[model samples]
Target: MKPVSILFVCMGNICRSPLAEGIFTHITETAQQQHRFHVDSAGTGGWHAGNPPDPRSMEIAARHGIDISGQRARQVNTDDFERFDLILCMDEDNLARLSQSCPPDLQHKLHLFSQYAHGTTQSVPDPYYGGADGFLTVYNMLFTGCKSMLEKMGADDVAS
Candidate 1:
């Protein structure tokens, strides 16, 4: 089967999206299903372009044995709408931003990352302003979402 390409998006590539990307990548690798997909992350805005993920993000991932410090921030672009099989946003605002910029016909590929979370939150709250505890909370949330996403995206990809 051809690998599915997935892009994780957020207001800034510094926090939630990168965490999701790292978590998803780690989950796939641990499952020995890394060959089944291509994963990346981007921001709706380019303010942090060319920069690495937030220090908090790197710290939290380090605690979990996932290395995400190498990933750099980039803004979502028109080409991404066509390149990725799926574009998942970290929250409602991120989804809205992607929806507006995404081409009309290809808008179907856009989605909320939290949909796979199965939690009380319909969105992954940004932890950029918080401390270590906030990062931990977001980490747990992404972990659950990423794990469920892998199971849902079997050989056939996303289900209806």
Candidate 2:
């Protein structure tokens, strides 16, 4: 089967989106299903593009035994719609923005990040304005969402 590709999007790639990328990548790799999927992240805005994920984000990932240090901030490219099988937005506003920017052929690929998350419609709050605790909360939320995503990708149901 062809690999499923996913792109996580947020307002800024520094915090939430990178966390989702790292967490989901870690889960897929650990499950030995890394070949089944491709994961990446981007921001709706160009702010922080080309910068490494925020220090708090890296530190939190480290604490959880995942490495996010390699992730750099990037803007959601027009090509991303063609590249990713799913373009998941971190919240409603960004979802709308992605919807507006995406071409007609790719519009079906855009989705809310929380749709993969079990029983939660909450946005992964932008932690850039808050303290370390906020990063931790974002981490936990992404962890849950990533896990759910992995399960749906056949990691949980597929036998090795």
Candidate 3:
């Protein structure tokens, strides 16, 4: 089967989304299912384009043994709607923005990242203006979402 493609999105791509991409990538790699997925991230806006993730985000990921420093910020584009099998946004704003811009036929591919999370949160909060602790909280949430997502997709059982 062709690899499943996923794109994680947030407001600036410097906080939540990049971490999501990194955490998800790390999880898939650990499960030995890297070949079955293609992962990336983008922002809804271009303000931080070409910048690396926020230092707080990178620091938190490093604590978790995941390196997200190499990921650069980029804005979501029309092509992203076509390129990814799933486009998961961080919060309601992102969901609405993507929904408005997404082609009707492709709308099904857009979703909130928290939808796969077993917890009650319906969205992932942005941690750009928050403290280092916020980044850690977001990381844990993304890890849960990514892990549940892989299992829901039936790709979590690959031999490590």
Give the runs in model 1 whose Cα sits over 4 Å from its true position: 116-121, 155-160
TM-score, every prediction = 0.93, 0.93, 0.94
- On the 0 to 100 scale, the lDDT of residue 74 in model 2 is 94
Tens digit per residue, CA lDDT, model 1, 20-121: 899888888877788988999999999999999999999999998999999999999899999999998889898988888778999889888877455444
Considering TM-score, where higher is better, how would the candidates rank from best to worst? Answer: 3, 2, 1
So what's the TM-score on candidate 2? Answer: 0.93
Which residue segments of model 2 deviate by more than 4 Å? 157-160
Would you list the rank order by lDDT, best first? Answer: 3, 2, 1
lDDT of 2 by residue, 31-53 (tens): 88889988899999997999999
Candidate 3 has a TM-score of 0.94
| lDDT measured at residue 131 in model 1 versus the true structure, 0 to 100 | 90
Task: List ranges where model 3 is wrong by over 4 Å.
Answer: 119-121, 156-160
Error of 3 at 87 (Å): 0.3
